[model samples]
Target: MDSSEYILNAHNKEEFPPAHTAEHLLNQLMFRMFGAERSRNAHIERKKSKMTFTLDHKPDRKEEKAIETEMNRLIEEDLPVTSEMVDRDHIPDGVSLEKLPEGASEMIQLVRIGDYDVCPCIGRHVRSTAQIGRFELLGTNWDEHAKSFRVRFKVIP
Candidate 1:
């Protein structure tokens, strides 16, 4: 048996949608800018929430700021978000997969932004990116050797 369980306590559905979705944008920017990959993600369910994740590598201050800026711009653009099913044998032209997740069935769910990020995901997202209403990633610190980072932030009201 597993020694521990990762549990998320969402008081209400209202607390999670936007913040979790924003993580996707941050994930893409980190990969594109710093060649970092998300190592793990744990989204907590509670009021005054916090979600933490790690990266393959640490990002510098400049890159981190750029990530914050670009993400906000995208959210401001209010990019339309949508998803569809694609055959596993058929990878859509031009679309990219960050990492091949195992145990995926024959068909994959594709979550997309008009001219932004596109990858297979099975998570909840806002109707439009803009709904995220500003991005804030708290306590930007990471250990290169450990390959770990802790980010605790919530959406702006």
Candidate 2:
């Protein structure tokens, strides 16, 4: 079955399977690089996606490039994109529940990218990392008042 089937909702909105999955991978990468929180806000779409992270300072060009490079490297690794439903009590440590919406079910769906990342997600994803192709960093923005760093990106075939 196509991976796209996992992400589409009743609204019939177009959700790129690769992009949605890549967003999850990128969030883990950002956490490793900056020790900051995972995306607090994200706009996941077919054309492009944006995620916001709260950070003390903005990332420089070199860091931004590194983010893109690492994501691509992981994508090229061909890691399996797998998911399973687990009781909330079994949710592992270090997997944040912040992204989950209010009144989320006790049975959570966990998505894992090889040995790299694991998070509770209900979105659709490709069967493997290779399907993600390449990752591109379009631009970034920092909100001083909110102390939030926003990154815009896209996945290329």
Candidate 3:
């Protein structure tokens, strides 16, 4: 479809593209490793970001380190990041509409990171994975009762 045919949601925040892109990778990684859904809450910024996921059990230290390692590996792969405008009625398999805003348009913009991840998004992102600096997991907190795992992280150039 032509550019005019695409409808992007109104993004209120000017996010750091690298960090924003990393959030996508992290979300995909979390889903793959834990059978968890993508993070429903995220705070992406230039210096740091945080994402919270609901899981059946908290990931231990070894698993957390593996997350960092895997994220960096993906970034080093220099995967291409691209976006496509798809009709809302024909959303691709495995692409979830759960995160779409209530008033999202009929034409949705889907961001894909190589073959690793794809989701409906309107935020800015780097054109390639290598453009995202090193992925670092700074800390994590688990609320057992709530089954929530929150991770704080940042990227280094």
Instruction: Give per-model TM-scores.
Output: 0.71, 0.87, 0.95
Give the winner by TM-score: 1 or 2.
2
Best by lDDT: 3
Clashing pairs in 3: none
Runs of candidate 3 with Cα error greater than 4 angstroms are 1-5
Supply the global lDDT for candidate 3: 0.91
Q: Which order, best to worst by TM-score?
A: 3, 2, 1
For model 1, residues 1-157, the per-residue Cα lDDT tens digits are 1111322122233436687677677667666765656535556332333434456666678766777788788889988878777665677775565454554455667777766777776667787888878777665656677667665555673
lDDT tens per residue, model 3, 53-138:
99999899999999999999999999999988888788999999987878888888889999999998888899999999899999
**Residue 95 in candidate 1, Cα distance off native in Å:** 6.1
Pairs that clash in candidate 2: none
Measured on C-alpha atoms, candidate 2 has an lDDT of: 0.83
lDDT of 1 at 118: 73
Q: In model 1, how large is the Cα lDDT of residue 12?
A: 36
User: TM-score of model 2 relative to the true fold?
Assistant: 0.87
Task: Give Cα distance to truth, residue 71, candidate 3, Å.
Answer: 0.3
Indicate the TM-score of model 1: 0.71
How would you encode candidate 2's per-residue C-alpha lDDT over 24-92 as one tens digit per residue?
A: 888899889998777878898777899999888888899989998999999999999898776768988
What lDDT score is found at residue 85 in candidate 1?
70
